[model samples]
Target: MSKIALFGASGTIGSRVRREALDRGHQVTAVVRDPRKITEEHPALTVVTGEVLDAASVAAVAEGHDVVVSAVGGGDGPGHQATIKPAAEVLVEGLRSLGTDAPRLIAVGGAGSLRTPDGAQVWDADGLPEFVLQIMHAHGDALDFYRTVGDVRWTCLSPAAQIEPGERTGRYRTAVDDLIVGADGQSRISAEDYAVALVDEIEDPRHVGERFTVGD
Candidate 1:
């Protein structure tokens, strides 16, 4: 079992991932902006309340970690930018300032950068709701920042066309760059299965120095 430093533990994907990490017998230290917002109490986990947007705070929690997985989304509760971009900027610098080549860092990326049915890459747009688009751009910026890490091990996992809460059947297909859409005319995967891929990728990275997308 590895020791993982997790950010955004109170969020949707982060919450599930924190549970999954603990369920697998791994140790987790969740760094959060507020303590009251976090309600999970795990004997194997440590909840460190701090600003993910502060490189010093993030570096403090990231120390002695085997891996760092960020599931943070920016919003005031789903439609604000105050939470995301700053976090990305901080995480990037935090990893850079670690000054140690020990932990592997993987942040959640966006499906918006993936290709669409038109064979063209899509980008974050204003048409999408504020909450939906916030993380898209944030992740995109995060991944872009990671590109300059020089020696950090990173894999920005881009999800399929559709990602939401659902059942975990322990099965899903993986693809790189483009969106993975099922023949049924949809591209969706449960958060459970998404966590499966995320953990698997964490354990063994097949997309290092690159980005990949998941689908049915």
Candidate 2:
């Protein structure tokens, strides 16, 4: 089982990812701003106070872990500026300080940059709210930053156009750089199944140094 250091464990996607990781027998250290926010007790889970925006904090918690998973920007969390691109920059900087002892980085990304079947990007669609457009651009900026880093082994997983807290069907389709639309002409996946896909990636390590998306 992998030893994972998880950031943003109190958020929607992060909580589900934490549960999925623990259910699969992997050890998880849930690093959050306030430790008391995580009340779930598990044999394989450890909650600790941390600041994801600080590189020193990232390095301190990231040491000795097999993989560092950041669920920031995956769900409707606050602090749009702090959660997306800046978090990505600090995470890489912190991991870089560890030298060869650093674990792989898996970060939650946005679907805005993914190309649609009709030759337009998700964010390019009409009538998106200002907040959503901001988050999408932030994720896109973070992805651009990730693409320039070659020393640190990093992977970004962008969720579908529509993702919410739903049942975990344990089944989904994957794509790289392109949006995954189902036969129903919609792009969506339950956050639980997205957690499954993430943990599966943690175990298998297939999309390293690149970004991939998931849909139901």
Candidate with top TM-score is 2
Q: Model 1 scores what on Cα lDDT?
A: 0.76
For every candidate in turn, the CA RMSD to the true structure comes to: 2.5, 1.3
TM-score: model 1 vs. ground truth: 0.87
- The positional error of residue 99 in candidate 2, measured at the CA in angstroms, is 0.4
TM-score of each: 0.87, 0.97
Locate the minimum summed-lDDT window of 10 residues in model 2. Answer: 73-82
> Which lDDT tens digits does candidate 1 get at residues 97-196?
8776647777777787787777766563347766666656666666677676666677777777677878877798988777888989788887778888
For residues 128-190, could you state the per-residue lDDT of candidate 2 as single tens digits?
A: 887888889999999999999998999999999988999999999999999999998999999
Those runs of model 1 whose alpha carbons end farther than 4 Å from true positions after fitting are 74-79, 124-135
Cα RMSD, model 2: 1.3
